[model samples]
Target: MTLPFYLRGLLLLTLIGCGWLLWQDTSDDLDSAPTAVVARPTEPAAPPSPVAATASVVDLFPAQTWTPAPPPTPVDTSPPKPPPLPFTVSAQWRFENQSKIVVLHGNGNQYTLCNRCSIPGRIVPGKMLDAHYRLDKLTDTTVVLTYMPLKHASTLRLDTH
Candidate 1:
């Protein structure tokens, strides 16, 4: 005969919810509503959803088909680096024995380098630590070299001795 308040509200809500499907967070709703024995459809049941509308308002407009464009790909923009040198270069407490020289020992030659000066590239191993970057500064465990053209700097970390 007549629906209970919650059942009538549920039916009214079901009618309203179909129109607002895109804006509703209906994730918490129960899959099926509790049915009463006399609760039968007066007319044919409303189409289940906007997406599945057979003769509902959704059918009044052209079929809505949307395909999102693919995202753009990324490009890498970096210069290739040279291999690392393996020579032993030291600027420890002996940097200023008498003439502020840092010792480079390898490649059958020993270079006595001073701060703010560069090597000649002949004796540097693998040439990773290029002669272009001057021996700018030195400490017990590291050497700082400045690349003149770009003012870019590089480091040579020495193994503990």
Candidate 2:
């Protein structure tokens, strides 16, 4: 059976490619044949001249003077402060029973916060609610939140809307 035209052409090309590669490898091996190494006599180093002998020690080898490093920069020893509060009071309500509630709209969510309570969700991971933040106080027009980790307090005024 006769092979298809495309198959015959492919076989011919493969054979030619393999032969070319073999030829290239053999040619490279012949060209890289090792040659003999020839050694030349080495002369002794010349002695230093009078001018070089009279040169200053600093010229031959630089003098390394002791330089006192700049005094260690002062480090801040104060305790770290908490980051700014991300919440803002959007609305607030107070009942006759003295209970207060506020709607805090921040970070794209509304938090219904009551007096002396922790905010829902975490401001930081791996921390208790009280350690992360506390609703320290709630007034008719303002809310006080204390970030216990750094003892930082932030006040948000309630808006009528």
Best by lDDT: 2
Ten contiguous residues with the weakest lDDT in model 2 = 122-131
lDDT per residue for candidate 2 within 56-118, as digits (tens), equals 445667678699778999999988877878877676666665556777776667667665445
RMSD of each: 22.5, 24.9
Q: Please report the TM-score between candidate 1 and the true structure.
A: 0.32
| Model 2 misplaced regions, further than 4 Å | 1-63, 66-68, 94-100, 116-131, 159-161
Tens digits of per-residue lDDT, candidate 1, 18-61, equal: 86884454543544555567766789977678555655545357
RMSD of 2: 24.9
Q: Model 2, residue 152: what's the lDDT?
A: 82
Distance (Å) between predicted and true CA of 4, model 2? 99
Q: Which candidate's TM-score is highest?
A: 2
